[model samples]
Target: MHPDGFAADLARKPDVLGRLADTLRAGNPWAPVVPPGIGRVVLIGMGSSAYAGGVAAARMRAQGLVATSELASSPLLPAWGPDTLVVATSATGGSVETLDALRRLPAGLTTVALTNTADSAVTESCGAVVELAAERENGGVACRSYQHTLALLIALELHLAGQDITSLVASIEMAAEASAHLLDTETTWRPQAADLLLGPSGMHLAAPAHRFCSAQQGALMVREGPRRSAVGCETGDWSHVDVYLTKTTDYRLLVFAGSPWEAQMEEWTTLRGSTVVGVGGTVPGAQFEVRYPGDDADDVRLLAEVLVPELIAARAWQEQF
Candidate 1:
């Protein structure tokens, strides 16, 4: 992947998201495919697509719907039933595993494809297609597609829950503004974030459970673009899983900064003298804070905060060449 192209893909987020918002404002794209009496939802994808699907599935479950996100390559996909809905997401509409999963589903099942390409193999395989409309990422990165996937999946969640989508549309607009703010002011925060997060041992990212995809996607951007070692964990889970690294390594953590467990993470990081970078909200002991226009809103943070690490990854990746 070209680092400069990855940066360019990120820079277009606000515009692409604006277009997506307008498209949503026009109407619910899933209406034609999501029929009544859908008792269960199964979403499958690989990598960043799966990361976004996981958050969307959790949100759907919170709304009292039986929803689950599975890695496309999983051998244990739940048994499909007449009342089940399957959604397979692939940015390029060409993920082999996702397609294999789709092929395994019984023919004529209510299956949908979410992809940026309109005429991809995924679209031909699924009964319906909801294009991401994220355009091409010449960089070979999935940055814009990932954000659009999250936004669209939120819309799908609301639609499935029989809730109005106006709020989601507004949130998308807010995300666009937040993204623009971050991109416009990158010079103010990029260096410090890069320095604080790019430690010798690599980067660790944590986010609230509902927004955990941010951490995953952020870490993926670093590893995918810059080839850095990065790992993502749910904020509360960090104390149990990732805290040990802080004491032993030149640990650098990027906290997405809204978890109730932030204090718990801070307690350990402070004690270990680990470098911490906070985004979207306050982390009590963070060495650096990155804020933007709509940082206060959790939905905005979910949709926008990753831009910080993405920008850092792009810059670091670019400099290496």
Candidate 2:
């Protein structure tokens, strides 16, 4: 990788952390308040922004909060009231449905904003704004901004969960060092993506134990790579419940690991081949592999792993796009 390019990319991450820390600081000026009990933690956003919001809800649950995750456009909406904390997310702060949802939240509700654009409608309308890392560089598509929001949200989750994120301070620094070696090794991932790129634009398979809502986020990025269609689903659901429809060979599958059944699916995928790739125990007869840093490979490891595919489907496919 060119030093200029690497430096520029690495430089952007710190800027993200700085902005995020600033937002939490801004919130700090006021005493932190959680309703008698946050009846439910509600997150709303379209595309990756909403999906990224789930990261917070999950960690909050890990910390003993009753949390629920939903896309801003959930088919059936949640019951909103004063005790509800609705986190409205929008990368541009202008996603049509997300902005509309933000506009309609009940009065007295504790509404928070997580967005890349502090000046956009959603940001302007909320109680507080966690301005994300959307620099001028994130012009058309939001790759850099995506990383910014994901990391910032992660930091917030850790803070809220009462975990000492100080341990992660060193880990965050290592990402820069690791990203250097990471970009160099990811050159190999391109070759293995042959079948990975097939199907209806893109795919997602999330762990049941993990955030299944990530499918919504992964689909948005995949559609950018190929506008046909994209869907997020669970491997266990696909293997048992969704088995019939997927047998048709009409759409492609991007498998995210978790849940007990996925171990079996990896085995069964060979007998009935499914187009797959990523860092996991390969499906039998698996001919392709994507080798990036282990931390970077979490597109299989963590819920944040969605970035691996966004990098490929968005950045790597730049010319074809």
TM, every model: 0.98, 0.75
Q: Global CA lDDT of candidate 2, please?
A: 0.56
lDDT of 2 by residue, 146-195 (tens): 65655655665555555655434444444433444434555566445634
- lDDT per residue for candidate 1 within 185-253, as digits (tens), equals 999999988988898999999999999999999999999998999999999999999999888899999
- Alpha-carbon runs more than 4 Å astray in model 1: none
Q: Which candidate is the best by lDDT?
A: 1
C-alpha RMSD values across all candidates = 0.8, 5.0
Model 1 lDDT at residue 58: 96
Best by TM-score: 1
